[model samples]
Target: MDTRNITYFIAVFEHLHFTRAAELLGISQPTLSQQIRLLEAEVGMPLFDRIGKKVVATEAGRLLHQYGMKMLQAEMDAKNAIKELRSENRGTIRLAVLPSDLDFQLVPLFVDFKTRYPETSLQAFSTIFVREEVLAHKVDLGIGLSGSLDKRLVQVPLGSEPYELFVHSASELAKRQAITLEELTQHALVMYPKGYLGRDLVDNVCREQGFELNTVMEVGSASSLLQLVEAGIGATIQPKELLKQHPEWSHIVSIPIADPAPIRHLELTYYADRFISKAQQQLSESLIEFFKSRGVGEDLELRG
Candidate 1:
């Protein structure tokens, strides 16, 4: 129950080894094990499963670790709040960034941010679960999938991004100017797992056209999907911005989806309750301005 014990528990869970966790925590292996046992006694359940040489978290351990991480992060956020008041220009800003955002938007934005706040540091995490991390205070801002979010979070709509069919130049479909939702079903497709916004859009269109989806390969990474498409193995659906950013995909052709393009809005997500430092606020403003200058700010909206 103690934060110190929770910290030790988190360290062990991260490394999944007593010696490594002890080294990281600056404590002896026996002491760390004793503390973990005391924590297990307090929680009334086993946290980890140590079988042979491997150490893994039990189901109970996973749940407790999630809560412990939130507690530790909240504590850090409180300290940062005080530091923000005392210090003028030196602090770390953690931002959870989506992979798609990195290639196109982040470099210029990062350059500007660093130029303005030279003393500040930026940590960018490539993640899809931005809202959860923001609420936990693990990140100050995040690039989220869609405009919709919980009432406790604040969001600024970046713009609506349409999914396009990425086909290999050698493929017959690449010669075509545009492709429809129905025609797209005829080819073997590379897609992400369910719950991804791009995947959801593909499913919606496929369902609307009255065809059972046939996936050739389910890929996890966006970069890998492009590689598969370029290899003529399968076609993938991705955002226009993402494809445009990666111009090195000369063999990969991007075709605009027709008969109602699959579009979803991208947004900036942050917790309303968390303190937004001056540098954070400035970066947010600059991002909004960047979007505006790009001529995609018509549907912009702010919500808490």
Candidate 2:
């Protein structure tokens, strides 16, 4: 019943002598005898046979020894697991990110983070989640286009994503290096599905420039939109960084918008109340340093 008594009993069982067991356990011989007696009374079984100057373990004592070994092992294992968890050597970090983040912003950082902490597990879910969901602790953190967020949510601006109209090289619209929103609307616009965050950003910019979207097809994902654009189905507007790595897309003309130079804020958002784990904290530091080295943090603004 009592672990202290069981420990003493195990020591005595192994040594087969109270005096020697007490010496091994750093306890008095009389105290070891009293603890063994208490263990026997609690289990309602005499665990030892005394024959004059010698003591031998009974059936009950042997059984308890087997179970007591298991209990002690389990406790030791639990302690080791907790230590590893606190040290960020083992644990799961839940992350929710926008689909676009996989291309330029999050992919490199994720690769670096994994390399730095190979033991910490990452559970990633790509979604069109807003800051409110992050604030609610629905996910540990999120990476997406930044905007005005709830006061409860804290956003760390990673950088700015520049907007450009992507069109086929041979298309009449691609003749110019950069074109206006007015010029882009003249052609059929293939874009994200309505209510999507990226589409919302494009729509907001269009509205600010005082025009309505003339869309040809609505796509569910960025990859699908790029594919359609590549096939010359229709031209679409998207972040410039998304096309940076692909030289094939270079043939596709990208005309930066004039005047306001439409740009979206990219950020790493998490709940203010949430206590960031060691892994998350390390990740946040790595991200900030990466962004700063690239000159992204020079103009970062924290959104509430």
Find the candidate with the highest lDDT and give its number. 1
Scored by Cα lDDT, where does model 2 land? 0.76
TM-score for each model: 0.75, 0.66
Candidate 1: give the clashing pairs.
none
Model 2 lDDT per residue over 1-304, tens place: 7567777888888889989999999999998888888788888999999899899999999999878865654554466557766674656677787776564456777787898889988877778864655654556677767767667678889887678888888788777767777766678889988798878887887798898788999988877887888889999888876776456665677767775656777788886644566777777777778767765556666777
lDDT of 1 at 165: 88
lDDT of 1 at 168: 92
User: Where is model 2 poorest over a 10-residue stretch in terms of lDDT?
Assistant: 72-81
lDDT of 1: 0.82
